[model samples]
Target chain A: MTEHTLAEHTLTATDLRLAYDRREVVHGLSVAVPPGKMTMIVGPNACGKSTLLRGLARLLAPVGGTVELDGRDISTIPGREVATVLGILPQSPAAPEGITVADLVGRGRYPHQGWFRRWTAQDDAAVNEALTATDTIELAARPVAELSGGQRQRVWIAMALAQRTDLLLLDEPTTYLDVAHQVEVLDLLVDLNVTSGTTIVVVLHDLNLACRYADHLIAMRDGAILAEGAPADVVTTDVIERVFGMRSRIIPDPLSGTPMVVPESRHRMENSA
Target chain B: MTAHAVVAGVRRRARLTTLVLAVLAAALLLLALSVGTAVVSLPDVLSTLAGQGSRATDYIVLERRLPRAMTALLVGAAFGLSGAVLQSLLGNPLASPDVIGISAGAGASAVTAIVVFGAAGPPVALAALLGALLTAALMYVLAWRDGVTGYRLVLVGIGLAAILLSVTSYFMTRSQVTSAQDALVWLTGSLNESGLDELVPLAIALTILVPATAISARALDLLAFGDDTASGLGVEVRRTRLALLVCAVALAGTATAAAGPIAFVALLSAPIGRRLARDGGPALLPSALTGAVIVAAADFAAQHAPGLPQVPVGVLTGAIGAPYLLFLLARMNRGGHGG
Candidate 1:
């Protein structure tokens, strides 16, 4: 594979407002993603964490303010140009029936190619590397329809990796996976970040996993950021109560040195007593 | 089982399928040309096509069957390409032009022109083209909530198709018996009166639209992943869809104008092509070739099948395709993926 030069990318949203029809989903939110770091957005259901990710990926146009990439308004850049710099994997993308994993991953080369450019060896190398990185090289020849849920998710991540972009955004990449597979997926992302210095942002539902994997943490509620900082600083009992509307005890994870939330529920309290 | 090996295997299979389909289409075309009343031999057909044959052979091959055979090939290919494009664009195998009211729109308009306006030939074809375009626009408008989803588009198309079919039936009921009989033959999609005038316009349309379809094949493949994924992959989803829709309508319209919506060839060709190639992407060239082979073979069967009365090729295709469609619907209802 041709070694792609890593360009510095900065993604920031200012006063961003998003809506589906007339009903607003995300209202006037401003945040900047730390460059070359793994940032995780965590929030409860319907809090617009996915919507914020969509805005950053340019999948949804902001209703009020602007999202900027390196100080230029992102909406102004042509889609293909933006695509070469940023890669996104939506929450749940359907695979065409009967498509092999390699062929599906090769689609990530779309932005790097033109009508006449066709497929080249460089593309093949990129695809092969992505598959290898995701540990999906063994499943490359299998049809996507035949893969397990975890395998399919890895194949999708490999597709995004093949884009070879400086910035990658994933919306709930670990959903629908077993605990082992979820950690496996997150570990793959960490490897990518450490080796390639690719800036990564993911919207995650699992609070403990988010804390364990995030270099920078963002907690959100009602489409607004409640707290943002390192996991240790941001994962306080008060912040968790404010953000999730649930009282929780914060404890250090035995596996990782990050704060893990232990929710205080009636059933749990009764059992403990 | 390496990625390269798998990709190469698919490519090889697709190429082999294309070659096989091309040869089958050619053989069927020759059979259709040679096996009519006053049965000419293959040699005579070839000589006549090369511009040196007996007067009888020349009149039989060049003046009569060649135009019909060529019309079958071109119109069928056009329909196939259009169907493949639509199916991939909407991410539903059921989104063929015939099912989604494009051909119905053309058929409705052409029937109206023939019955109400007493129109024949080129004017009817022009009417069909306009009708198909208008119906596509209307379907897009009706299906658009925020954006057109495959499910909504197919549902809206089926509704429009029902309305157009009723309009066509009403027009037939109002026309004179003789005029209605003429419209009936056209409606059943016979290759009986296929001539150079009809063939040339469809040929021109295919020449332009076929290349356009080829160019958009990659985008169509990406679109199967849904609009958000496709857009994230750098496909200009809306623009690509609009361009593809226009191409699909023009192709289906031109084919309908020529042969009155030869039933289900478009609907059947892509899936068959995909199966033959064993590839997941939109098999444009393979589908087109498969369609040509199907129509040419169907026309031959319609003309020469023993103990069967003379019938339009459309009747045979519809008889064959409708059962398959039902089977598909049953499977989908039983929890198979419909889209």
Candidate 2:
């Protein structure tokens, strides 16, 4: 299951414009994903973060400009060819009815297959490796329908892992998970980035978790990027307030010394002695 | 279990189910040929099929029994494959072609060709194919807002079916009695007049369509989840959908043109095949075989049943399928939705 060190793949969007029907959601924007780093895109609801992720993953076509993968126009490339080096896990993807965990994860090997489907030992090895990485090996025989929310989330991650892409994108991977499970999923992603050198990008809802986990941080508001750098540089009070429209105090995490946001809630301020 | 082991197990089960269904279909085919007023013995029937029989036996087997039985099997397979494709692609159990009025669309078009243009043969078959495709496209447009949902698709299909059925009826009323009889047979979906005129075209259509469906339909398992997920997995989602949809519509159309819109053969074959195979996935091969068995058996009964009068093959399928449709709607309602 050992992967050779991946060649740095540059994923970039230049003056990208996105729209739903006629009303433009994301204005012309440009950004480059840092190769081999854990980059997280954080913003409030409908900030076009998910839309940008969709365009980056080639799930949505851009209305203007281009998204280039390794200096080539991504849309010009064949879908299966692109899928070999880049994979994305969309938020709230559902499993087919009564599908076993192993079978669902096995679907991640789709791009690598010929039109005449033949499941090989190599595919099986990749699936088994992914199940192990996501700590879902025990549930491989279980139906995805019977799994708990957190377990199911891990199973989905395992499916993405089986794809073995050099760069992976996820949109709101932890939207419905509780605090502990969210942290667990993040830690698992970090391990993947560190061990396999996968270029990882995520759209996150939780500010503190995004700050703590991301090596590179991008702050977005109103369909445009406001700041991007290390967590300490881009996650300041002004950016947080502008992005989320909330007041907050920035503090160092005691455990990791990462920049963490302590939201100054109205209840906290007025009720304190 | 190991992942490959699991895959192997699923494959084994699918293969085993297909083999069993094939045997059952073959046995029924033999029975269909042997049973009648002549009561040709199994050996004689076998020898006749092998092309080594006397002229009298040859006449009965090839001229009389073979075409009818062949029609039943081919129509069953076409509808079975078409329904499996629709149900899987739309991610709805109730989205069979007939259930969604695609059959009615084909019926309307073929009738229009017959009564209005005085057309027959290949022209009528092409008309049916065009009709089915247009109706499916219409249903998609009417039902689509942001994306299609199963309930809305089914509802839109029923509305389309009603309008198309009325078109068929109007054409029937305007035509002469002979043409009206033709329209009536199509409207009711009968196999009584099935012959080489029907069987040859239906067989050729399936021969082309089935392989095309087999290749394009590989995306179906991925598509069953959602469009986003399917595209993410490297499937050319729109292109794949269009190709598979066309194959299904053409199959349904040609079969309808040949057999007069055999009802419920497409509808029940899928679930029955899935259940029989004991597989949760599409079980497409099993579904096709299940369809063949249903039609062969239904045709046999329609011809030979002691108490009942001679009826069209469709009458039996409708009697079985109509109730299942109600039960499915009731259950889908209870479950809230499929999409």
Candidate 3:
């Protein structure tokens, strides 16, 4: 479980053009994921942040450019080979009915198991460690359908963890959760990154949480990068307003010392005026 | 519970359910082989199956009943496995071959051969198989956009099924009475006319297809996660889907060629197998065994059920399975998980 370090692979997309049925979602995008760091992509809806992540994760074939993993073209590599080094948790994956948490997590071992090489102790160990890491060992026997939204999300994370990959990508992992559960999910991801040094990439909707948690932050708008750097450096009032089309005030977080955006709503601005 | 223990428990349960279904299928096979006009005893049937019984018993058990029973078992297993693969691949309980029109396509074509072309026996079976394969190809071509999605495939399949059913009705209405009667019996799915000629092709198909399905079972399971997650997990989503679709079409086609689309065996087997196995994964083996048992038992009842005239096995299955489909629809409607 502890054999692989997450810093070995470099994930980069070079001038990628991604489209869904001729309508380009991401146009001429180039980005390098910082190795061994937690990077969060934040942007308004339909801004193509998720599309870029999908391109980087090799879920979508780029129409124009290439995505490289460890200096190799990702499209040229065998899928299972790529899977061993990278894992992604897509948003809103539907659980098969009556699937136990343990069984669902075990499916993450798919890439590792060959036709002749059936399940082994190593696979069990990976699944067990993933379940234990996510604090879902107790729910192993329970059906995923019966789990609450937070528990279900943790189980999904545990599944991605069970893949035992160096790089992990998640698209809005905290969506549909309440504030507390959102924090819990983010903290769990942070713990995973810190403990295993797994390169973590997330597309998040919450600006404050993204600012607080990301080691590197990227802001996207209209299918292009607006700004990317450390949260303290890139998450300014001007960048926030430009990316989100909203007026906002930037302040340092009291607890984390990260830049926090405080949106200035029309009612609040009028009241102050 | 520990993950290891939980996995072990699920596996144990699935294996136990499969074993139980296997035993039931075996017993039903024996009943199907022995109970007929002669009503051979179990001992006689066993000895005849072992090739040591009297000539009379041998002729009854080995020659006539064996082919029929084998057809029921093989066709049921094929439909079961095919249904399990399609349902898991599509991630929808409603996406069985029967519902999605693969069987209807075969039925329509077979009926056309009988009514319009005056075909009989092997030629009709060949026509059915061709129809099934063509319908599957058509469904895939129509469903494909960026790639085939489960919902789109099912929708296209349902539409095709309706069109094929109308074609079959048109043929039936235009045919001579006796030929139409034969086509109707075949459409309702019967094991009465089974012989080595029909069973051999289906047997050959299963020998190739069943193993192929087993090899792709893992990929099929991953596909239930939707295309994005499945591809992200390293599954070649399009290739895997195409492979599984081919295997499923072949299985359904061969079974239809043998016994004319056995209604609902393909549809009911997977869900029942899943429930009996008490596991989340595709219960392929259990579903196959469950299908064998259902068809064999239904064949037995169709022959021996007191006070009822000898009807085709499909009539009984359609009677039993149609209500279940209604029940499923009601459940889906109430739950709003229509897909």
Candidate 4:
């Protein structure tokens, strides 16, 4: 695994349970995400990984427990107050029709404005900073719909960054992107964490990339944590087979030396079974 | 140039466009006031406005023309702002008061008041307000089964509006021809001269409602970002939406009650405002002003049209607005896929 360091605020949970339409999605789950670190929550489809992320982001209310953002109950805080501290970028945020990149990014400053307040120099600076940080400065005035998948994803990241919150939660930010674009977004997230000390909590499906890039890895199965710790210490062949319910060959990533999982499919499964 | 200079330039350009539109609207209002069938000259119109004209000029100006002009201004601005706000909020260009049922609701209720109680003496405005509010409330409840999706709300509103419209037609068929003729103006969205007494209240209502809406323009900008994002950005999504809806209903309802469903003011003004503003930003204030200009101008045109008996200002607006609505629909269909 690559060398990594954990940063400080304690994002903790207690007896956190989540449900939809009276059916439980996430069981009693508890975990602490240290501040200023990249934590990736990973699992297969229907494993409640996204549900858990939504619960943590306060988009989904917990059925039985509370998520604590620095010791205070998150739900108890005013919505805007919570927004000022934490920003969540949901998967597939619907863009308003005919909206431009600059206008869309400017919306991220909503929490900072008042009824009478026009966009200030500070707001512009933050918007420009976000655009440059995500390398979308050149496309600032272009309509968001015209951007490629990768560029659009970057524009969304720029929007979230414009919020300027301490903690950023992204649910499958890399979805619908090509592998190259996926790496670019992940690298951008890594750069944000490393440079600005913004705590990044991401829900990613790719186990190998999760292991390679995340400072902390959280492997979940059936809405409960199967493993959580430093990636090198937590990701292993046994953890993969047990948590993922698959037979896999765990090898080092060719570039990063992080543990890479090569799933044994139907052809290989015949001999193993 | 610095970034501030760039932003300033954009703002100044927008301001200039607004100023030009304002001048055009004012010229239209003056022309509307002066050049009617009575054909009062500009000097006579000016003297009448200053309250110092011949008795005949005074009667034409104060008794007939002034009330109609003022009604047009109020109704137009109200319609335009409401349409713009609704369109932006729902992210649909077709989401005008009539299409979404606000005016239909008002029309239906006014017809009911006339048919059932034979309600007279300004009761139409009250009935219209009640109907409009009820429809808005119904639409709100139906669209909120989960969260208010823009498409769901518009669809529900259109359906509800259609139902109210059929009920209105049914009532018309059953009523006496004289009653039907009386109701016809309100039903088709007319501006009869009798509703002038409703003007003071309408003006007062606009004064309160328009400013309140202007204050929430920023929140509306956030709301157009979609509910979750808007909420995440510190907007109380439900509350802000409710507030805006209240303002829109009150503005449209009051104006409709006073002028009997003045057509296209709410539907056409906001979009026209958006185009005139030209920055493509949500042009709330300018939309309101444009609405006023359109209503005033249409009323003028109705009074001045030669070889035809004067139609309700509503008739002329409908004649104009219906085509624009159809044009928009045709344009949408040609695109093969649209909202």
Interface RMSD of each candidate, angstroms, one decimal = 1.5, 1.6, 1.3, 2.8
Model 2 C-alpha lDDT per residue in residues B104-202, reported as the tens digit of each score:
899899999989988866687788888998998999899888666656887899899999989988998899999787767666777787788888878
lDDT of 4 by residue, B1-339 (tens): 333344455567668767876787777766766776678888888888888999998888778777767777778888888888888877788888888999899999999898867885478789998899999999999888656877888899999999999999999999988888888866766555643687777888888998898887888877776676777776777777788888888888988888878877788888788876654467887888888887777776676767758778888888888999999889989998557
Clashing residue pairs in candidate 3 are none
Per-residue alpha-carbon lDDT of candidate 1 for residues B205-235, written as tens digits (9 for 90 to 100)? 8889888877878888889888889889887
**Top-down lDDT ranking:** 3, 1, 2, 4
Collision pairs in model 1:
none
Q: Write the per-residue lDDT of candidate 1 for residues A77-137, one digit (tens) a residue.
A: 8888889889999998899888999889988999899864377788888998999999999
Q: Score the docking of each candidate (DockQ).
A: 0.64, 0.64, 0.71, 0.36
Please provide, for model 4 over A1-273, each residue's C-alpha lDDT reduced to its tens digit, 9 standing for 90 to 100.
Answer: 011223434578888999988799888999888789899999878889888877877777798999998889988877777787788887888786666687678778777777665787778888888888899888876777899988999999999888888788898999999999999999999988988788999999888889899989999998899999888888777898889888788778899988888888877466554
lDDT of 3 by residue, B1-339 (tens): 699999999988988998889989999988888888789999989988888999899888888889888989999999999999998888778889899999999999999999999999999999999999999999999988978888899989999999999999999999899999999999999988989988888888899999998988888888887787778789998899999999988899999999999899999999999899977878889989888989989988988999878889999999999999999899989998677
Worst 10 residues of 4 chain B by lDDT: B1-10
Query: What is the per-residue lDDT of model 3 for residues A35-142, given as tens digits with 9 covering 90 to 100?
Result: 999999999999999999889989999999999999999999988888889999999888887889999999998888896338899999999999999999999999
lDDT of 4: 0.81
What TM-score against the true fold does each predicted structure earn? 0.95, 0.95, 0.96, 0.91
Model 4 misses residue B18 by how many Å?
2.9
